[model samples]
Target: MPVLSLAPRRSGFGTELLTQTVPYQLRGTTTLTFKPGGLQCTIELPAKELLQ
Candidate 1:
């Protein structure tokens, strides 16, 4: 997980105040399989999954 924050900008004339937050998008397929000895995990992702 991650967090993003926008800060205000300072100019010569005055200070511009700005506040915004954008969240990350996740797109994928996760699979978990159990075997005799151990556990196995697999993930399937698309080509344009992270284009957002």
Candidate 2:
């Protein structure tokens, strides 16, 4: 299994950025699936690691 971290950037003009951290597990397979949205993304991990 692996961990991921995300950081948000701040603007001097009073604007803020949105950020999030998502954790995923890696199994014996080697494929990563993700969906992208407006300023956000969703990721799916393998099955084997989920059982661990």
Candidate 3:
């Protein structure tokens, strides 16, 4: 898979933004199924790992 594009912008929320290290987590299920043609998949983080 390839990333098409990314656009970053400042939130202007001040110092708190600079001091925090945000955890990366998945919000949905990542599924992989086998088929005759190929394997289909959906990538995402699991809810159990989202604890902050």
The Cα local distance difference test for each model comes to 0.38, 0.33, 0.42
lDDT of 1 by residue, 1-52 (tens): 3332332233322111111111123455545454554435465556675555
Query: Over the full model, what C-alpha lDDT does candidate 1 score relative to the true structure?
Result: 0.38
Q: Per-residue lDDT tens digits of candidate 3, residues 24-51? A: 2234544445455554554555556666
Off by over 4 Å in 3: 1-24, 43-52
In model 3, what lDDT does residue 17 have? 31
Which is the leading candidate under lDDT? 3
Q: State the lDDT of candidate 2 residue by residue for 1-52, as single tens digits.
A: 3333432343332121111222322422222222232223334555766677
Runs with alpha carbons beyond 4 Å of true place in candidate 2: 1-37
Candidate 3, number of clashes: 1
Which residue pairs show backbone clashes in model 3? 26-45
Cα-lDDT of candidate 3: 0.42
* Model 1 misplacement above 4 A: 1-25
Clashes of each: 0, 0, 1
Between prediction 2 and prediction 3, which has the larger lDDT? 3
Higher-ranked by lDDT: 1 or 2: 1
